[model samples]
Target: MADQIRPKWALVAHGGAGAISRGQLSPEQEVAYRDAMAVAADAGAAVLRAGGSAMDAVEAAIHLLEDDPLFNAGRGAAFTAEGRNELDASIMDGATLGAGAVAGVTTTRHPISAARAVIEGSTHVMLGGEGADAFARSQGLEQVDPSYFFTERRWLALEKGLARLGLPIPARPTGAPQDLSGKAALVHEEGKYGTVGVVALDAHGDVAAGTSTGGSSAKRWGRVGDSPIIGAGTYASNKGCAVSCTGAGEYFIRLGVAHEICALVRHKGLSLQAAADQVIQGELTALGGDGGVICVAPDGQMAWSFNTPGMYRARIADGEPLVVGVYKDET
Candidate 1:
């Protein structure tokens, strides 16, 4: 008789955290994003079903989001106030506590690949700015034109943010200052948008976490935030669970959101849902911070918690996995 075989696993992903609202996105755009999310979730589920590591599944899922221009990460990243494109990303394995990250890199085609390189190649846990770029080149990772990140939508968004906030329009030394107040005012006049991330558990019950982002629109130089930091933007532990977050990056760093959620499960005996809720509503909100997180436990349970108005998230589990693209509170 053939050997019996079965596998159980789960995956969760988030596009970002911010003032996302359904009113701002058209019905056509919503469906397109949901379709993309489904493809990403399936890619990850296939790896998990084949007995791949949670880390592998999470990374696979994120690759799709990274390539999607609809989200502000990887290929579609937003420009900084100075009209530059710098990206940051990180990945963590709960089983080994092995973590890697890259920040302030402009040439690496995929920032996450550089992060993985860091974990596999170095004794250190983090690398940032130009040093991170040099490391990516040394590792022989693929490179892309910095302009590969340019998107008309993101460019307009940057301008809108600066003008509304009364900041100067960054000008090129060789060119006259471009008029952008109109563009800035148009994209963010309503204060609506967010980021992307993923958390996963494999058949072996191992946990993994990954987060990728283009950084804040028009951010100042060298302003590295939480995305490239393990505990702040992402965390995972096979002993409990895995988590990926998006929101106010500074507050997430201060609260150590991802690690705290895992800790709640390990130390306070909280369920995945309970832990995430406590962190988003009880801790983050209490601290006067706003954001959200997507998480998964070894048992295959998943949760998306947010104190903000909405979180662009998706989950795959059981016989019927589903993607959630709405911007309002699901609760």
Candidate 2:
């Protein structure tokens, strides 16, 4: 009976958020970002329109984004202080409240899939470091050499980050790309806050959310951001809405932005837009954090809010056309 129920559906996605502005991206660069987002969102929307579960739709969307170099997730993830790539991702099912996550993953080809494996195949809600990669390997997920994630654009960004922070720049990765002469100007404030996320409402009236990131460039130690932490960067609930956030990971973590948004909607009788606005505009801003979120509810509400100059975002409802935005003005 429950499986036969069909309901309104929608999907929303974000390709990170930060001080992105109108003149910041070249016309070609802007088109590339928008096209990539549309393709990813379309992939997920196709799944939902085909009667896939919210969980599957969310995974389908993020999986495509993780593969794109334009957005930081898998292939173009940021470099750590050691110049190595460490990925993080998380996903949640609104129908069951079952969530999974992975942090500091080194070799998994798709961190989003690895996170889903945690929810469906393992007892744990989260896994980290070598163990997380090992578990992903055991599940037969694709594995890549560390160098596979390295891009010259990100390598230079690492140096700039170290310089800006007044820290020593580390040596390049062992098998790094050789052509680092150019592409530096192409890398700017946007890459520093790069992450990808998706929120979907499937035909079953279930909502699911997922988020993936490469963390901050030149992040020291084993710093894990809010991306892989349940209730922090990702949250979904059948009772209200699903949310995926990209921002200053530290503040988002402290504020529990994802879960907080859903809580406001489900508990405080706030509308989805109001709840999101209050969090991103009021609470997060008050705390001196700037970023954005994409949300979808089972009732067909799709909303996004960011305090920065712009956020790369897209959303699509059942029969509607896909809409995308890069700057703050594109409502």
* Best-matching candidate per lDDT: 2
RMSD of each: 4.6, 2.9
How high is each candidate's TM-score?
0.89, 0.95
Model 2, 204-314: lDDT tens digits are: 789999999999988988999899999899999999799999989999999999999999989997888999999999999999998999998778788999999989899
Residue-wise C-alpha lDDT for candidate 1, range 1-331, written one tens digit per residue: 1112222778898887777676876676667666777888888888888889888888888888887777778866777778787899999998899999888888788788788889998787788878988898898988877766666667777888889879887653232234434222223211333456888887776889999888888787567768888899989998878989887788889999999999999888798899999999998999887888999987777888887766667888646547665476553
Question: Which segments of candidate 1 are over 4 A away from where they belong?
Answer: 1-7, 171-193, 329-331
Task: Provide the overall lDDT of each model, using Cα atoms, as 2-decimal numbers.
Answer: 0.78, 0.89
* Number of the top-ranking candidate, with TM-score as the measure: 2
| Candidate 1 TM-score over all chains jointly | 0.89
Candidate 2 regions exceeding 4 Å error are 1-7, 179-191
